[model samples]
Target: MGLFSFLKKKSDPADAELVVLDTRLRAGEPSRLDSEAERERQRAIARATAAKIDEIELAMASDIFDDEPAWGSAARHPAAAAPAAPQAVPAEELPDAAALPASAPAVEESAILYANGQAAAAESLLRDSLQDFGRHERLPWWMLFDLYQATGQEAAFESIAIDYASHFETSPPAWQPLLPGPGTPQSAGVAATESLCPVLDESIAPRLARLLASNAPLVRIELGAVRSADAAGCAQLLQALQTLRKEGRELVLAGADTLMTTLRPMLAVGDRASGEAPWLLLLELLLLSNREKDFEESAMDYCVTFEVSPPSFEAPKRVSTAAPATGSGDRFLLPALATGDCAALLDAIDAYAAGRDLLVLDCSRLARMDYACATALQGRLRVHTEQGRRVELRELNHLAAALLRLLGYGQETGKLRDSLRLYPHRY
Candidate 1:
């Protein structure tokens, strides 16, 4: 019987026999069917249905797989028809499918593993991939570099750097260790305190002066919170910075780049008829931060605008030995990975956000966030945003940013959710 005929005759004697035979096989009993031809036909239909289910599942899960070739093309052309394949393209013109790098899966897998605290497994997989396809792919190599740096495996990082340079014929990534994990003890020094406020106006100058008055050798100012700045505020803050530099006090300008972004629009290159304080402050920030390239460019602009010599860029005399604090003050640091319900994380965020109008979640170390956690976090953020409070997620990795974007935290119209801000990691 044909496949469809067998399916249509559901109540036939042959169907009953097939059911009984399937039940017996499932129970590990030997089948004693006498009709060999009928049994073979039933088995063929079963295999076909199972294959169809697999195809359906694949199509549902991923867009890469096409079901038309298996279902439509086969049905349109009978198996008896001879296949036509006479076209021959030059070897040079042929697409090199095998040579194409398949790095996304490997990169995502390694990132998830590392985020989940499975560093060893992630390292092993990266090493194996490097051995298998490292010559053709640079992503795995860079991932391995990041892994080593994150894990503080300096020796292994150097070893890989040498190999990477030789293989890629270029410089490998620099070893910039991430901040210590949560609960890691601060080094033996006076810990830097949080910023005074989120906005940089005339009022913040006195607060900064007080901070400078303190005897602490290392002063960390959270400039990331400064969303706006005025001339008076900028001048005061610049004076304080100059004092700190002259006194040789260790200064850490957290979020200086963010402050520069806020200041850039206030000053035009060579059109700086006013707002000289902001320009000077920007130059000071670049100089103190040891950003020579940025300082040089701004210095040239300063000279053209002010018709005076700009300050010379100076390298930092001493580097602070203390480990830089992560997520100071109102900022909550998300874990390396967030999955499942994430109740504890949500609670921590609530506690941090309580009695505060601005909520900053530092996601620099957050490598991956599953759908469930992303949903939970989005619900919490929505409530906070509706209550007229601002929420900022800072330095999120690409993977977590993508998931948040998927959940509607960031929209395609260049606007985020109401009172919500997402600062994805740069490079």
Candidate 2:
């Protein structure tokens, strides 16, 4: 009989009788038909039943169920079934369907574009942003102000100043033109002189006097190297500054911040133990640098410390100088933007680095560097490094630093010659 026929006979009377006989054989008790031959027959029947079960299981595990749709074969073999068509999602149900990507702030974008030498685009964007968002934001206004001043747009600057004053209900910032563009030589008319010393002590009093008596109209006293000051030095420096002001001579205090840092710690409110020289000198420096707010605060402190009347704030009458160069005579100040043909800039740097083993380029005013200029500068600095000389690019703004980094200037490396050394801006 076929396997199906044999399985169908499981419910037959003969099959029931065999099952009864098997049960009796398994009991291990003597039966009326008990014999060795009967026992062997029962054992063989039991083995054949187990083999049939194993065969059924093996068939089920194979492809035997493929033709049996009643057993849900489609569910068991999903790959064989066709996929259902996708249903469209409602617009409201879609994730972030109306959300747009966030963009950089208008002021930041304009500034970066200006730095990258896209002055027209930068100015246009600033103007548009001023119209759309200027009521709520002040940065765009200030940026436009600086842009106009830098580009020498006096009429536009004045027009915006009027709008600024009317909108903010206050006086607008004055229009001060920026210094000559990058690579332009300093004018010969101003006889500029530099004084380099490590400390502002009593020993330098005679030199200070000479500076005061000098015929040169412009004198820059390098205070970056000054680590400490005494009462005598402070008083002497104060006297020279006063004399210069009385004579209407131009004075630039290079690295005044560094000296201020050294002086601030030695001073305290209601403590005049260190005398008024340091206090008075710091106040004078603040005044000469056109820092009225800082001067006022320090003046208040001086008043409290000395129990005497503090000097009144006086705006510097001289033409406002550029940001104080922060180092000695060897330092080279980079312009606000380095873009387009930077041949003159590179030449100026070469001239500055000619006599010095160390090249110090100050980027305190540097806002951005175009790709070509950055590449050229990288090459120049690389040559300087290869010659066993060190190059320090100091006080770099974040934007300028990012460009230099993109050009592979300052890389993480094992040797100093491999990359440019960058000092981040202190502020």
Candidate 3:
């Protein structure tokens, strides 16, 4: 029981030496992290752990657990044992992670490195693993997206976005809930609020019309008139939107217009209704999608029927007229024009008279015309009246007579001057 007491004493010298060596030491073991081989080993462990987690997530997403009949005590009934007898194998032969061969050793090692917090090193390794497993339809796209987004890797986001779109957009309805039906316009824009306007009265008009039909707490707007879509209708819609903001919901417009132009302060709706457009599916992502995403380029996939350029909205300046009538003297036989667009109507008239030197135009049956139409008519009269054969209105319908009279034009004397140009004409 001398110095040998702390060390288990062995009768022989060699045995004593072995006993001392085997005894547990008081000092903690030095970190094995510094060693290259040891570091690689830790990485392997981490990768395995991450892959296992991925497996669990994949199972949850695919509903494989619920789809499979419950087995053992996990079953609801009190005395349940195991799943009953025969198991049916899927036709495609589902990938069995438990039985799949180790096709990629480096990927497994890289996964380990990532789990060990050496994410940079693990990145290549994970890529390799993906390459090995990418053949399967279930290639862990979500996990890949999370990793890339977390790393702020733009290329990765683009690559993953493409894959995600392909998978979610093309898959059958059961597989992807967000894919739009046939004939819908596909899009991906940067800012949510900036995409509320489109030209040719196609953007806000139809959207506002549709909004009128929606039961959402927020207002849904559809554009009704092409002429008014840009100025008055747009302004009216914006004012309505301002009123809607205080209700705690947003304004959501569905159509071809980009978000910022369609929804933002460009129109000056003032107060609540102007604050935010209501929510449609993609628009709802303003609240639903938390992360800010950028586009590498404009996307060709989204939820709409058409992708229209912004320029086509400017109405044509020339007007079209029927061939000269043999009875230009009879003012009552004018044609009936039906156009919600004032500018187009005017343009057609201008073009018609411009081409034909001497002709008489009829407006007796002119039911109604919006501002653009009024503007166009004034523009044409300015040019034509000075040149002799000026335009004339004949059979004034009740609505037409009132419009012309209200516009400050009396049959022959008061010419159809551009009402908007000289005076601030209010609707």
The most accurate candidate by lDDT is 2
lDDT of 3 by residue, 271-352 (tens): 3332222212223222221112311011111212123221111111111111111121212122234334445445545655
On TM-score, the leading prediction is 2
> lDDT values of the candidates?
0.62, 0.63, 0.34
Which runs in model 1 stand beyond 4 Å of their true positions? 1-187, 319-427
Question: What TM-score would candidate 1 get against the native?
Answer: 0.40
Over the stretch 103-126, how does candidate 1's per-residue lDDT look in tens digits? 455555765566556778878887
lDDT, residue 397, model 2: 47
If ranked by TM-score, best first, what sequence of candidates would result? 2, 1, 3
Per-model TM-score versus the true fold: 0.40, 0.45, 0.21
Candidates 1 and 3: which is better by lDDT? Answer: 1
Model 1 error, position 314 (Å)? 0.4
